[model samples]
Target chain A: MINAPSPTQSPSTTVPGRLETRGASRSAATLAFAWRTALRIKYVPEQLVDVVAVPLVFTVMFTYLLGGALAGSPSSYLHSLLPGTLVMTLVLLTTFTGTGLRSDLSSGVHDRFQSLPVWRPAPLVGALVGDLGRYLLASSIVFGLGLAMGFRPDGGVGGALAALGLVLVFAHALSWVWIVVGISVRNVSAVNAINIGVQLPLTMASNVFVDPATMPGWLRPIIENNPISFVVTATRGLMHGEAQLSEVLWVLAIAGALLVVFVPLSLYKYRTHRS
Target chain B: MTHPVIHSQGLKKRYGNHKALDGLNLEVPSGGVYALLGPNGAGKTTAVRVLSTLVPPDGGAAHVLGYDLVRDAHTVRSKIALTGQYASVDIDLTGQENLVLIGRLLGLGRAGARRRATEVLERFSLTDAAARQVRTYSGGMRRRLDLAASLIKPPQLLFLDEPTTGLDPRSRIELWTLVRQLVSDGTSVLLTTQYLDEADQLADRIGVLNSGRMVADGTADELKASVGGGSLQVRLLDHEQRDTAAQLLGSQLKAQPHLPPDPAVVEIPVIGSEAANDALTQLHHAGIDIISFSLGQPTLDEVFLSLTGHPTATEELA
Candidate 1:
């Protein structure tokens, strides 16, 4: 539909310079529109609830149950055990994105937003970015629960904080993959079934619950190099007074590599769907 | 003259092999209501979606408010608001909150958005129920809130796709009044509906679409007249005299006998009211008695039946 805007209809000048003019080549109006959409997530507290409680449950359950089973004593296991449980909790919480995305699409909110003036990428980016607070909250509670169970990091405050940061980045990276699955499958039940199928094999196969060395030699390398296992091992090492520069790089590398593949694939699917 | 507010050339949309909109072309002039009338599966909604910038056309060119549909889609969206068949209000938010949220999303400041929301709520007669959650609202209130959300920024063009679809009779009349009020204020409106009465009540011009094509486009009177202006009918007294009267009236007044199955009497139909009066004099001169007589305009339902081979109930909308 193209007709030139009437001379008297220049509403752009009505916005103040600070809101209308911006650093990015894109119009500031576009940016503020995206920000408003993101801020609307404040009313959606249900999405954040799962993120908060899952980590606390996992940390407490594992510290008491798996800790006594794997290590000689529950307290002794807390030293080496709390780090892996935290990583597992982060991965478990990524399913929220898959379920949330599917619910939004099926409930017709996605179609409703399609008619709005907001950018196509705005909703997708907002949902992912909004979960950043959830990820942070989950990570903090797991660490706090671990500390309450008498688990102390051998690394200083900076090293422990860096290790927690690594887990968060990895979780955020994997979230893109879940976002793709959510958009593709587009059903909450289907997402839950598929995620459980993948998660069971991946978590049990990694070093989240036990030492990779305890496994047979052939399977050891896969577990040692399993990205989840690598993050878990590095985090455990850092918390117990053993820190290494190479381990940090490995965790960051896994996050960066997943970002390289899944983010573009998800965006490509998103752009194509037209929903 | 200024370009039409909406213009489309060869608009085509396909969902897999099923063609939702097959080469639809429409031009709506600025101001007044333009109604898209079609039975279900006629691609009316698809056409609205393409024009409103909600769905991309597979092949075509459209311009809305001087903005190209494809390349200048963002500009087109900024100038237009679409309220689809279903009420898209968020059940979790209050009616006022939904309108205010949409205003802010359109880049209105907090104070301005709230003020606009209040104004639109009052304009739509929803001021009393503004604080209630949308889920608690009646069907009519929810639909009114949906329309108010679309009007927060005073969009130059509005797309109302079946705005009266599920409303009860009273609610439908209320919405019809609101639609008239909006068009009178210089806002151009494009409305799509299967209900002929809605179009008759609200549209300045009507376009009838069937099987993904516009079969006829004209003012309501023009379309009605195209199918024959009016009808005249007369009933007779006795079943025994039905055949006798049919032959006499057919020869005397040149009207068809549309007799219904009944033991008592018969009826005849003619194209004009004068024909009935002519039949009365002719029948009396021929020693026949008349029971009743009537003159009336052809309804849109009759117009639809004349144009399409079948009725609309079996057909579905896109």
Candidate 2:
């Protein structure tokens, strides 16, 4: 069948000026990249695994291991654990942005993108948006599981929802750093190795497992100041209805600072790199 | 002369210590096909990439469709489309979806994008496979889909980098026919290829690139002229006649004459069709009875060999 222009359609606009044409094409490229990235999520949904498993493991482990030690009872500890799982899920799911970007680069997909008339920001923005779906899917599961485990946020519904929102922004902001890693490096396995290898030190150095004040001198400085520790701690505080504006600001500050630094670097490398 | 659609002056690209495009210059008119023929690593793909705004050149200036190479990249990109050596379609998407996505990306409305997608698919004879995932489609099918995607916006300039590299002979011919028809409709195409016959059949002008430089370029006839124009081959009924013919033609034609092992054949090289005709007239006047006489034009392969002093390498379609 010969598919022709629809009856309702008039002539396509041919805008004057070279700059206008370029801008229009770039916009089109951005939309195409976004659609392609979104469709890819359907086939390879590895982010789901990270989002669900990480939060579930952390929730179960923390409630069982530290519940009696910290809260005097597993039931009491469970009441305040929902916020930690929610934040952790978002963080875990967001890290896949790097992995996915690296995979695309290694698999000839990036080369394909390079050949197009795409805007410089399209791939970066598309990848970020695509990973947002992962964050949402995983965060909701953590929330549902938290509810099933008897963990109720002392914060009202608005506070609880606001906490979720904070996690999403934090995750997206952190995604920029990994996008740099993905774009610069060609090996996905190396990305995974580096990410997984560094994560333990980072997690242990934070306030995830124990109270920061209880640590020794040198370790206490690093652990207390760690970003993830602040996120988890602030989230825990938010769930208890004790909103810490300072801590939330700290998370936002870190996210914003990373975006300021890494986004430009990624774009610069993207524009200059030889294919 | 009318202003060329593409003009390059001493374009150069380097990879660390290695130069990929070395002091290259080219000019193509507003329409028809211009094929860049080269061996492996000769920089055909690099040239295309640089012109398409996908790869930056280390030196030299190029104006593509009247837009500056570096300053007017966005403008150049808007007017041009590239179908790379490999199909650039998203394999996860269906064939139709890939084209529609490109159409929409090119600023078509949702309904318009869908219509354009269907139009291109039907044009490429891909309507039957429109709904199938590209990953499941055959290589030739994906190649056609990729070409269709590039044409969705009806770009004035198209860069087809080795368009039929991995295709079956039949599919290759089909694509060639389509490409020819596109050129006929006023689209200018720059096709880079290693397939000599592909250049011979498709290009209005063929530029033979070697070692990051254009060693020779012109219409197919001009390329052939570089290798002594044309020749005449005769096969006699006996070996003595072949020897006598070679001897007679050698002194008269001012050209090389050779006798094969079969001994019944003789070949005479000439500068052009006129010289070939002159040789035939001289041979008949000399009472040399020839069983057969055939004129031969040098192939692109021979022209490449003559220009580069080596066998033509494949175009490294990176």
Candidate 3:
């Protein structure tokens, strides 16, 4: 899938050169890494499978299976379900950041990167940026499928796009926590195990599936305080046109807290990682 | 004289209880290959890792390319590259993509990166495999691509940790030639290898490492001369008396004897500072009978054996 632009021919084989270019700027380095992460999609098509299937399966399942009992009907329930499912989809996708980072940390490529003349945090940040494309794919799938299933939104396309942007931000912030996990874990399998372990409770226990009012009394407060709840509630509000200020602030606050806490923690763990 | 490419003082690193580097000091002058010759587990890789800024040292410090190792690490990183033992290119990426990625990181524009990648592929004879994922490449192919990635923009200094390990004879020869060309182009290299001939052929100077520290350092001829004369291989008729004979030769001759898995044979390196005949006489006086003894020639092995008291790891290099 890769094509070298205007491939050149060397007349004679010689040694490696006096450098033809200067050192890359930090942004350029990060962008290069992001380009690398994006390129991997070509080789590992299975990643694209998850990107498409998860939102498709969950949207169909939640609307048809649980929607009748919970929200009365499939079309009626999807209005609430579509936004929540998008939140869950993006949130779950965030875990993969850790999975990839864990393997990259163990691989010898990490050594090569560590010894490179680029910005140190470029690889991690660039991977997240590249992953933003996957989030965009998932968002578009949910919206497209939601519209196909006759789930209309009062807030219109701009609102849905705004919600898409919001969830992408949340995904990036949440990914930092996993970055720490990725750096701390001994192996890629451990990252996957923890991802699965945490994903179930984090996505399911939140208001993504059902309203907290329908949940048990003790679980209501627990769900209300969930960070994912803030994200889901804000996403739902943005998609429905009336963006609740409190929910939006809460979402921003939670994302801010995750970044504030985990960004440095992950970078520190990365710097001190015993590779 | 210009500053050395690398200068370190008492660099120390530990892995739990294992001291990977214990007060290791090194100096590599600019513009030539300086070989760190050691057996496996001799801390060669660890030393390279620390010097390349891939790992923070437990204690001590260094100046790589005249930049402070810890304080000015970014500056050090800007001037050096490391090709580790493993073929470290991204296996998931095509060989061409790996080079382009590295080229971009080295500050080339997209078209510049692609052109450089093509040039590098041609130079490394990897044009055929450039479009294939690195994971599909053979070991030699991966190694060449890894080396190509490192050379996208030749840093001021290069750290090659056993760069030719596991390579075939032809590839090894090709790599040696490349290293010479790089050096002639003024890229100082810190190379670590267990092959005596590799060091002799490529190194401007060699450092013998044993147990996380340098035992001797010099040019190939100087290193061989440092061993004094050579090694004394003594065979005993009695296996039970081997320890006694070893102790006799070690103390009396002031040289440690290496037992090379043969229960009845001990090789005592004859350093120039110490006399072997006196030890042989002492062995005879102490009633430790030997079948025969002979002095080995002053090859690179003898030099290593004299300094570290052990031979380099045996490999069937073609």
lDDT of 2 at A99: 75
Best by TM-score: 3
lDDT of 3 by residue, A24-90 (tens): 7899989998899888866887876674576578779978998898889877789888898889888
Best by lDDT: 3
List each candidate's DockQ score. 0.16, 0.18, 0.38
lDDT of each: 0.73, 0.75, 0.83
Instruction: Report the poorest 10 consecutive residues by lDDT, candidate 2 chain B.
Output: B309-318
Against the correct fold, how does model 1 do in TM-score? 0.78
Candidate 2 Cα lDDT to native: 0.75
TM, chain A, every candidate: 0.78, 0.83, 0.90
Q: What are the per-residue Cα lDDT tens digits for candidate 2 across A165-260?
A: 777888888788787777777677777776677754575466665677877888888888788887877777776779779988888888889889
Give lDDT: candidate 3, residue A106.
80
The candidate scoring highest on DockQ is 3
DockQ of 3: 0.38
Model 3 off-target regions past 4 Å? Answer: A1-21, B13-20, B39-42, B56-61, B70-72, B166-174, B195-197, B232-295, B298-318
Report the TM-score of chain B alone for all candidates. 0.84, 0.82, 0.79
